[model samples]
Target: MVDATIGQGGHSYLFGRALGPQGVVIGFDVDEKAMEKAEERLKTLKCRVILVHSNFSQIADELNNQGIKGADFILADLGVSSPQLGASEFGLSFLEDMPLDMRIDKRIQRSAADIIKYLDEKSLADLIYQYGEDRASRRIARFIVQSRKDFPITTTGRLANVVCRALGNRGKGRSRIHPATRTFQALRIAVNDELENLKALLDSAPEVLKRGGRIAVISFHSLEDRLVKYNFRKNKEENVYEIITKKPLIPTRQEISENRRCRSAKLRIARKISEGD
Candidate 1:
């Protein structure tokens, strides 16, 4: 079993408990703190737990180095974890005032602050449009570029304020989502190189899983859901794997009410259909 992006080990703990003593579970996370938390939680589990501080895109090579050719089951829950959003260091949420650093992996040199300060207006606008899918990307980029001229926009609060100012305050009982939500999400995704990492994972998963092995991915946004959908369809057409979920599965209304973040999540499953050379 493999748990990619094993955030707080919530999913892996359950996977480990079911695996028993004979089963081995390999987990990956970019955040050292998250790995530490996961270790503490999974310490007493019956299965052998191996945790690595790395991105899931490296899963194929990592497994091969450990003398494991293929896994029977693999799972990836993509997106920012709850703790990350609440943590000040990550700067993932605008709900709290924090440094504009969204690098989950501290090793990453370029941060959200760097992007805000360095990126040209057109490039920034393009990034916002492509990643955030926001129609007012140009206006937001203009606001950011103009705001940073007076002083470096180095805090989440300032960035959020700029976005809200550029887009205008529609949050006054008009919309549940904040005006800065999409822009913040775009910055987070860019800082982490999320989409490319996800693509790499998708490209490598089939080869890493054994024939009949199952792979499950839980994505939190439309961009991710679309990528999973099309990739699964392409793989199915090529006879590499069979899609287990015809349509992506979403959280129930009850689940959404209990956990508002789960409202956007979609789960897609697929199984390897052929053996590798």
Candidate 2:
């Protein structure tokens, strides 16, 4: 079993428990802080396991180095983790007043700060609209570019507030969802190259799966879901895999009512084709 995005080892520990002694569990996360926390959490789990500090996008090479031919189960949960969002210097949440840094891995040189500074206004607007699906991307981009004329936009809260001013038209109260949600998402996606990384991960998954092995992906956004959908369909058409979930498995109403974050999550699965079909 491979638990990609093993943030805080929640799912990894579960996999470790499920696998027992007969199976091995491999988990990967790019954040060292998360690695430490997850390692601590999984210390008592009784299973043969290896925790890797690397991006799951490089799973093929990492698994190869670990002498794993292919895993029977692969789980990739694509979204920023709560730890990354809540307890980190790298700003991921608009609610937080922190530096504009949003790189999931500290190794990555580019940051949300760097992206906004370097990317042209057109590119910035496009990024917000495409990745963020932001309705007021143009207004937000214009405001950001103009604001930098006074001083560089350096903090997440400051930027969020700016986006809110530019886009929000309040009668009684603030928006149901913060006006900054889309802007923050756009910045994070650009900082991490998330869409490209997701594409690469999906492209490489089939090759790293043993025959009849299953791969599960949980995507939180439309961009990711579309890529997963297209790639899974393409692979199945090529006879490389079979779609395990004809339709994505969305959270139950009860689950969504309890955890609002899980509302947007779409879980899809596919199995590598058995030898000789």
Q: Pairs clashing in candidate 1?
A: none
TM-score against native, each model = 0.97, 0.94
- Put down candidate 1 lDDT per residue, 12-101, tens digits, no spaces: 999999999999999999999999999999999999999988899999999888898889998999998999999998988798889999
Question: Taking the tens digit of each residue's C-alpha lDDT, what string does model 2 give over 1-277?
Answer: 9988888899888888887878788888888888888889988878877989988889899999999897899899997886678854877777878888998888999889888777778888999999899867888899888888888888887788788778758411544767788788888888888888888888878878889999999999888999999999999899898998999999999999998889889999999995632
Using alpha carbons, what is the TM-score of model 1? 0.97
- Point to the candidate with the largest lDDT: 1
Model 2 regions more than 4 Å off: 170-175, 274-277
lDDT of each: 0.91, 0.85
- Worst ten in a row by lDDT for model 2: 168-177
- Please give the RMSD to the true structure for each candidate, in Å: 1.3, 2.1
In model 2, which residue pairs have backbone atoms overlapping below 3 Å? none
Look at candidate 2 and tell me the lDDT of residue 41.
92
Lowest lDDT 10-residue stretch of candidate 1: 168-177
**What is the lDDT for 163 in model 1?**
93
